[model samples]
Target: MTTPADTTAPPPRRALTAFAWFWVGAPLCWGLYELGVKAAQLFTG
Candidate 1:
Protein backbone atom coordinates (compact mmCIF):
# COMPACT_ATOMS: atom_id res chain seq x y z
CA MET A 1 0.00 0.00 0.00
CA THR A 2 0.95 3.67 -0.52
CA THR A 3 2.31 5.87 2.27
CA PRO A 4 2.50 9.56 3.24
CA ALA A 5 6.05 9.79 1.87
CA ASP A 6 4.82 8.92 -1.60
CA THR A 7 2.14 11.60 -1.37
CA THR A 8 4.71 14.22 -0.43
CA ALA A 9 6.85 13.61 -3.52
CA PRO A 10 7.10 16.17 -6.35
CA PRO A 11 4.80 16.15 -9.31
CA PRO A 12 5.58 13.86 -12.22
CA ARG A 13 7.90 14.55 -15.16
CA ARG A 14 5.17 15.56 -17.59
CA ALA A 15 6.09 19.23 -17.41
CA LEU A 16 9.67 18.45 -18.35
CA THR A 17 8.48 16.48 -21.35
CA ALA A 18 6.18 19.33 -22.40
CA PHE A 19 8.91 21.89 -22.05
CA ALA A 20 11.25 19.73 -24.15
CA TRP A 21 8.68 19.57 -26.93
CA PHE A 22 8.19 23.31 -26.82
CA TRP A 23 11.91 23.91 -26.85
CA VAL A 24 12.28 21.91 -30.04
CA GLY A 25 9.10 23.04 -31.78
CA ALA A 26 9.12 26.78 -31.14
CA PRO A 27 12.31 27.50 -33.05
CA LEU A 28 11.27 25.24 -35.92
CA CYS A 29 7.95 27.05 -36.20
CA TRP A 30 9.61 30.43 -36.06
CA GLY A 31 12.04 29.45 -38.80
CA LEU A 32 9.23 28.26 -41.04
CA TYR A 33 7.31 31.52 -40.53
CA GLU A 34 10.38 33.59 -41.29
CA LEU A 35 11.05 31.62 -44.41
CA GLY A 36 7.48 32.06 -45.62
CA VAL A 37 7.63 35.79 -45.09
CA LYS A 38 10.90 36.03 -46.97
CA ALA A 39 9.59 33.94 -49.81
CA ALA A 40 6.51 36.15 -50.09
CA GLN A 41 8.66 39.25 -50.16
CA LEU A 42 10.81 37.75 -52.90
CA PHE A 43 7.75 36.95 -55.02
CA THR A 44 6.10 40.30 -54.43
CA GLY A 45 9.24 42.28 -55.20
Candidate 2:
Protein backbone atom coordinates (compact mmCIF):
# COMPACT_ATOMS: atom_id res chain seq x y z
CA MET A 1 0.00 0.00 0.00
CA THR A 2 1.09 3.64 -0.65
CA THR A 3 1.04 6.53 1.78
CA PRO A 4 -1.22 9.56 1.45
CA ALA A 5 0.06 12.79 -0.09
CA ASP A 6 0.56 15.98 1.95
CA THR A 7 -1.82 18.86 1.17
CA THR A 8 -0.69 21.28 3.89
CA ALA A 9 1.43 24.29 2.99
CA PRO A 10 4.88 25.03 4.32
CA PRO A 11 5.44 27.36 7.27
CA PRO A 12 6.73 30.90 6.90
CA ARG A 13 10.46 31.53 7.27
CA ARG A 14 12.13 34.12 9.55
CA ALA A 15 15.16 34.14 7.26
CA LEU A 16 12.98 35.06 4.30
CA THR A 17 11.32 37.78 6.36
CA ALA A 18 14.68 39.22 7.37
CA PHE A 19 15.94 38.98 3.79
CA ALA A 20 12.85 40.77 2.44
CA TRP A 21 13.11 43.45 5.11
CA PHE A 22 16.76 43.98 4.34
CA TRP A 23 16.02 44.11 0.62
CA VAL A 24 13.51 46.95 1.13
CA GLY A 25 14.95 48.58 4.25
CA ALA A 26 18.48 48.84 2.93
CA PRO A 27 17.51 50.93 -0.08
CA LEU A 28 15.02 52.97 1.95
CA CYS A 29 17.63 53.76 4.60
CA TRP A 30 20.19 54.54 1.93
CA GLY A 31 17.78 56.88 0.12
CA LEU A 32 16.93 58.63 3.38
CA TYR A 33 20.59 59.01 4.20
CA GLU A 34 21.35 60.43 0.78
CA LEU A 35 18.34 62.76 1.04
CA GLY A 36 19.63 64.01 4.37
CA VAL A 37 23.08 64.56 2.88
CA LYS A 38 21.68 66.54 -0.02
CA ALA A 39 18.99 68.34 1.95
CA ALA A 40 21.33 71.19 2.70
CA GLN A 41 21.28 72.19 -0.96
CA LEU A 42 17.61 73.07 -0.65
CA PHE A 43 18.43 75.86 1.82
CA THR A 44 21.59 77.06 0.09
CA GLY A 45 21.62 79.66 -2.71
Candidate 3:
Protein backbone atom coordinates (compact mmCIF):
# COMPACT_ATOMS: atom_id res chain seq x y z
CA MET A 1 0.00 0.00 0.00
CA THR A 2 1.14 3.59 -0.77
CA THR A 3 1.94 5.93 2.10
CA PRO A 4 -0.33 8.91 2.76
CA ALA A 5 0.89 12.52 2.27
CA ASP A 6 1.70 14.72 5.25
CA THR A 7 -1.11 17.12 6.20
CA THR A 8 0.07 18.84 9.38
CA ALA A 9 0.81 22.59 9.35
CA PRO A 10 4.20 24.12 10.13
CA PRO A 11 5.06 25.05 13.70
CA PRO A 12 4.56 28.60 14.92
CA ARG A 13 7.52 31.01 15.07
CA ARG A 14 9.28 32.02 18.29
CA ALA A 15 8.76 35.76 18.49
CA LEU A 16 10.32 38.17 20.97
CA THR A 17 7.70 39.52 23.37
CA ALA A 18 7.65 43.04 24.83
CA PHE A 19 9.21 42.02 28.12
CA ALA A 20 12.01 40.28 26.29
CA TRP A 21 12.55 43.31 24.09
CA PHE A 22 12.79 45.59 27.10
CA TRP A 23 15.25 43.30 28.81
CA VAL A 24 17.44 43.24 25.70
CA GLY A 25 17.01 46.90 24.71
CA ALA A 26 17.54 48.55 28.09
CA PRO A 27 21.27 47.82 28.30
CA LEU A 28 21.76 48.83 24.65
CA CYS A 29 20.11 52.18 25.33
CA TRP A 30 22.26 52.72 28.41
CA GLY A 31 25.42 51.95 26.47
CA LEU A 32 24.50 54.37 23.70
CA TYR A 33 23.80 57.12 26.22
CA GLU A 34 27.18 56.59 27.86
CA LEU A 35 28.93 56.65 24.49
CA GLY A 36 27.22 59.91 23.57
CA VAL A 37 28.35 61.53 26.84
CA LYS A 38 31.93 60.41 26.30
CA ALA A 39 31.94 61.69 22.72
CA ALA A 40 30.64 65.05 23.87
CA GLN A 41 33.38 65.31 26.48
CA LEU A 42 36.02 64.52 23.85
CA PHE A 43 34.73 67.34 21.63
CA THR A 44 34.45 69.94 24.44
CA GLY A 45 37.65 69.07 26.32
Candidate 4:
Protein backbone atom coordinates (compact mmCIF):
# COMPACT_ATOMS: atom_id res chain seq x y z
CA MET A 1 0.00 0.00 0.00
CA THR A 2 2.85 2.38 0.66
CA THR A 3 5.50 3.80 -1.66
CA PRO A 4 9.24 4.42 -1.16
CA ALA A 5 8.80 8.15 -0.69
CA ASP A 6 6.25 7.66 2.08
CA THR A 7 8.60 5.50 4.15
CA THR A 8 11.47 7.98 3.89
CA ALA A 9 9.46 11.05 4.81
CA PRO A 10 8.61 10.23 8.41
CA PRO A 11 12.11 9.49 9.74
CA PRO A 12 13.63 12.77 8.63
CA ARG A 13 10.60 14.67 9.93
CA ARG A 14 10.85 12.98 13.32
CA ALA A 15 14.54 13.81 13.58
CA LEU A 16 13.92 17.40 12.59
CA THR A 17 11.09 17.74 15.09
CA ALA A 18 13.31 16.55 17.94
CA PHE A 19 16.12 18.86 16.82
CA ALA A 20 13.84 21.88 16.55
CA TRP A 21 12.42 21.39 20.04
CA PHE A 22 15.85 21.20 21.63
CA TRP A 23 17.26 24.09 19.64
CA VAL A 24 14.36 26.47 20.30
CA GLY A 25 13.47 25.52 23.88
CA ALA A 26 16.96 25.68 25.42
CA PRO A 27 17.72 29.27 24.43
CA LEU A 28 14.17 30.50 25.13
CA CYS A 29 14.23 29.14 28.67
CA TRP A 30 17.69 30.60 29.32
CA GLY A 31 16.60 34.01 28.04
CA LEU A 32 13.52 34.01 30.28
CA TYR A 33 15.58 33.19 33.35
CA GLU A 34 18.14 35.86 32.52
CA LEU A 35 15.42 38.45 32.07
CA GLY A 36 13.87 37.56 35.40
CA VAL A 37 17.19 37.91 37.17
CA LYS A 38 17.85 41.28 35.56
CA ALA A 39 14.41 42.53 36.51
CA ALA A 40 14.92 41.50 40.11
CA GLN A 41 18.28 43.23 40.25
CA LEU A 42 16.80 46.49 38.95
CA PHE A 43 13.98 46.39 41.51
CA THR A 44 16.20 45.50 44.44
CA GLY A 45 18.96 48.00 43.71
User: Each candidate's TM vs. the true structure?
Assistant: 0.55, 0.58, 0.57, 0.50
What C-alpha lDDT do the candidate models reach, one value each?
A: 0.85, 0.81, 0.75, 0.80
Q: Number of the top candidate by lDDT?
A: 1
- Ten contiguous residues minimizing lDDT sum, candidate 3: 7-16
Q: What is the C-alpha lDDT profile of model 3 across 1-45, one tens digit per residue?
A: 233457565443335456788898999999999999999998898
Model 4: per-residue Cα lDDT over 1-45, one tens digit each: 333674544444667778999999999999999999998988898
Ranking by TM-score: 2, 3, 1, 4
Question: lDDT by residue for model 2 over 1-45, one digit each (tens)?
Answer: 233457555555768889999999999999999998799788883
Question: What would the per-residue lDDT of candidate 1 be over residues 1-45, giving only the tens digit for each residue?
Answer: 333575667566788879999999999999999999999987898
Off-target runs (Cα >4 Å) in candidate 1 are 1-12
Ranking by lDDT: 1, 2, 4, 3
> Which of 1 and 4 is ahead in lDDT?
1
Better candidate number, 2 or 4, judged by TM-score: 2
For residue 15, model 2's alpha carbon misses the true position, in angstroms, by 0.5
Model 2 scores a C-alpha lDDT of 0.81
List candidate 3 stretches off by more than 4 Å. Answer: 1-16
Instruction: Estimate the lDDT of model 1.
Output: 0.85
